[model samples]
Target: MAEPTISVIIPAYNAAAFIAEALLSVLNQTSPADEVIVVNDGSTDNTRQVAASFEPHFGGRLIIIDQANAGVAAARNAAYRRASGELVAMLDADDYYLPAFLATARRAFTLMPDIVLFFGDTEIVDANGPTGRLNSEGKPVRTLPAIEIDGLFKVRGSTFTTLLEGSYIPVCAAAVRRATALAVGLFDLSVRTSEDRDFFCRLALRGPMAFSREVMAHERIHGGNISISTHRVDLARNVLTVMRKLRRPEHACLMSDQERSALEAVYKDEFFNYVYNLSSAGWRAYVKGVAMLPADERLAALHPKHLARALAAAVGMSSND
Candidate 1:
């Protein structure tokens, strides 16, 4: 009877097509997890059958729980709620970890005992596999922060504000201390999108985070991509929601004086960045962005002048209109 060191959590929903691959990734880890917890998230597909089939092999280390259909956020919440590990690594049903992911994390904890969380770069995969290892712009995917900590890298600016612009730490590829995840209240059940960004944002406020350039997981970009499939319209809106949530009265003390100030200033750029991008999607999406934008930002996005500018941006004309 020894304590479990880490639990690999796979939140599956209608992932029978890919759950087996995801499970094998965990089972084949260079440094295996102490236990594997899969929450069947009420998938109508044979995800349960596919997941449960591995039980006999796990030899009591596999725990599969079933519940009525809840979103991925809720499924993940349920796993951690019942998990008995000190640390948890998240793996989406469509995405899986590299063999060395656990080994790298174990080495990191041994070297940097103070870090509460650590994440690494991810190799992007498409329906066929490894999209030639390039980002959307056809450039090699590389981790790019200016500072080095131990063997990892971090942003030159405030990590919280840096994260505000968008998500850099791939939650699927990250490993976090269970206590820290619980202390931050896990993922917000209320938000249907950007919940991952929101959860990590809260974690960033709690302590230093390690960003290892080493590729730890493969992010599959099939048509079922969660954000695009589930909440494409809410992309900008959810980010804005997370920014506002982090600034709530209860979490005020979690931020430092500098982080607090940065939140205010960064909100402006983040607001413009997300909204303006939406504006290019068309006036309809632009209008949706306007509705989700903060009150002050709403006024700016709805202005007649900004409307003209949005039209120009949407049609490939000069936004100086």
Candidate 2:
């Protein structure tokens, strides 16, 4: 069999309700993926069965690998090892891609062969309504200009700083060259969350990344999502782990005073937010972060916007009481 131009890897765990839609979205792509590998990470539900249903439709083009219960990072790494394509794309089992995702990615890669990674805007949908927007903070939400290598460094720090502060790019909306991903050593399985952020930061250090204006991915926000249900303590711990990793020698030269300050502020906010979410010992973590901040900048983290949100949350809690 010939190698495919693009390999889509979907890591699924107990995603029976949405895995079928996710697979269909890929199969319906105008420029269908040459290979689609779905990694079943010891799902307790019918995730494997749902993935198997697509094999008859996609035939040899679809591949399924069952593994012990591992985190998404480990699952993704396992899938990447098995993929044989120039371009590697990721689609979470619960997220569906737009029909134009692969076609747009192919065109973008062809136009800018030097780009190591490419990502598009994403739409957020929930049971209540559609957010109808991409994160406005990182990599401007409007139409992206054709950027070159020189342009990358000019905005890399600011863009990455914003993304690290909060997850701006949906995991399902990203695609990277296989070689670049391998060169970067794939995702880190040590951290439970923020693995994608760490992976992108490492990749950004290697080569230029292109952005597409169109929202080629749909992110479903549901009660079951880790982002929504996971305890803030766990989230904060993983975020801190990611931050500590960034301070290593490989990324040391890239860190500027402003970038470091931004990172510190983000940690402070996370600590406070964890407290607001009622996580145990969050206050202690917040105090520790505050103590670490430079005296002059400690107050900067208590910006009016954050203060207001914290106050609002307090009021809501009081009302519930």
Candidate 3:
């Protein structure tokens, strides 16, 4: 097997409907990936058949692995373990990359030899069409010392706090050195949701991150999105887990003061989500969250307001009151 300089790892579930487009996007890259590995996570659909169809076209460059019904984190880890490329790019089976993605990655690496991870801008599209740039609750992504080339803003490093504000880097839009990913221990398998937050935070700690302002990836928003399909309460709980994980002693030093503030803000947002989003149900989840989180003045200060809102909501009192 010829060693691939860049290995694309794709974790597919029952994504037979879209895996072909995803694989074709990779194959059509302006700078092609040396290898593409697809981990089929026990998809009942014909996902394997679709992925295998491209093997001949890729001429031995496409590799497929079959695994039990593991979550995305486990599937990614499985593909990572089998990947032999110096650089690893992650793509979900349902999402596809733009032709310039690999070219931008290669150029970014050439510009900054020490770049640990390079992520491009993403455009969110549904069955309709392009919506706009991905908007998270956090501040927009901007470079510290930005240089514009071919309409792409090049940044030397992306602030950890900026990332902690929200999920700025979509997995499909990001690429990392194989060694950097392994050193950071790959994705956290125990986490079922918000795993990207945990992984990206840890990755940012290892070295500098580069940003390509151009939208080089397309994020498909469908009802089947795991983060969207899951109940909000469950999503809130998983986000809390990520928050607590970031607060661990070993990871604490990795956060700057601003990053800590951003994390706290995210905690408050979670508090609102789990505590006040659905009144009684939210109250129950919020109580569990309170028990889970360590006592902090920041959280304490926001409790009464959230509690009042939850109670008011329970009593059918509108905010107009």
Off by more than 4 A, model 1: 1-4, 134-158, 224-233, 272-302, 306-321
The window of 10 residues in a row where model 2 has the poorest summed lDDT is 149-158
lDDT by residue (6-27, candidate 3, tens digit) is: 8999999999999999999999
Clashes of each: 0, 0, 0
Give the alpha carbon lDDT tens digit for every residue of 158-247 in model 2.
355655665556679878899989987899888777788888877766666777666888888877645542356567667766776776
Would you estimate the TM-scores of all the predictions?
0.81, 0.74, 0.82
Report every candidate's CA lDDT. 0.76, 0.74, 0.77
Better of 1 and 2 by lDDT: 1
Global local distance difference test of model 2: 0.74
Ranking by TM-score: 3, 1, 2
Of 2 and 3, which scores higher on TM-score?
A: 3
Worst 10-residue lDDT window, candidate 1: 134-143
191-240, model 1: which lDDT tens digit per residue?
A: 77789878877887777666677778888886754654225446665666
Kindly report which residue pairs in candidate 1 clash with one another: none
Error of 2 at 264 (Å): 6.7
